[model samples]
Target: MLYKVVSHMLEQEAVVEAQNSTQAKRKACRLWGVSPSDEWHGISTMQARKLTEKERRVAAVAIKHRNICLHTDEGGSTVSIRNTATALSVINQLIGTDTGYFG
Candidate 1:
């Protein structure tokens, strides 16, 4: 009976995972500059690793949103803005990368 309960829980978790993946795929599809749905849908284990790398890259760049700079002007070029890094990260996430540095 305990085994059956554990098995049922595992099955339910799998179902939830599938649903989450589907939702993620749909979201990725809606995003114009994101990976194609085909790439995310029915993803293989290798592809899952790739996706994880992408997510890490995104997270790394997202750190820039908290950046604060001291400049004569608030919106001056002297102020460091990491927008480029963020964009690069997003692009890398959209496309698979060979280097695992993103991880």
Candidate 2:
């Protein structure tokens, strides 16, 4: 997707294609200055590590909402999540998501 990279100067922006928004931010940063934050989308960047094979599998995609569960191969059980943002943040940590303050 083509993500818009806007600097503090709003008027100073650039467009670039990337696998995800974070990648876009990185590319924008390379252009000179671009600060990336989860607040970019009014969201916070989630940090997560693999708990098992299934967690690994879950990390492969983006989960938009919370209150969802995902199963892994190593475990014969499922894990229930509470918050959507936290879960998504975890998933995002594995795969980049644009948590910027934008829509």
Candidate 3:
């Protein structure tokens, strides 16, 4: 499928440029003749490895509340779980990490 081809190109770019995941994605776009304005809806496992620092920060913040919930007003346990779920959803939306591993 298209995903497999793009993924292979991305990996090749990574090996060629010695770049990380994010860079490889950009490279793949170029290889596929995709413009920067193009909207990408999925993130392969490679992309997850390349997540930008900003995304990583957001994901971390999203997950942090879960730990906080363990100590503070544990009464809001549902709220904490909700936030984490929302965070996971956002991450999945932005980058397809195939979090099925969590299950």
Winner by TM-score: 2
lDDT of 3 by residue, 1-103 (tens): 0111134323432111224545545555555465534444223423424334554454566567543221233333332435654655444433433332211
Over the stretch 44-88, how does candidate 1's per-residue lDDT look in tens digits?
Answer: 211211235444444344444533222233352222336744443
Query: With candidate 1 superimposed using the best TM-score fit, by how many Å does residue 78's alpha carbon deviate from the native?
Result: 14
What RMSD value applies to candidate 1?
14.2
TM-score of each: 0.28, 0.30, 0.27
Runs of candidate 1 with Cα error greater than 4 angstroms are 1-19, 32-61, 64-99
Q: How many backbone clashes does candidate 3 have?
A: 1
Positional deviation of 44 in candidate 2, in angstroms? 9.9
Error of 1 at 27 (Å): 0.6
lDDT of 2 by residue, 6-79 (tens): 55433344444467766766665655443445254211232212134444334323333333343445544334
Candidate 1 overall lDDT versus native: 0.31
Q: Alpha-carbon error at 18 in model 1, in Å?
A: 12
Report clashes for each candidate as comma-separated counts: 0, 12, 1
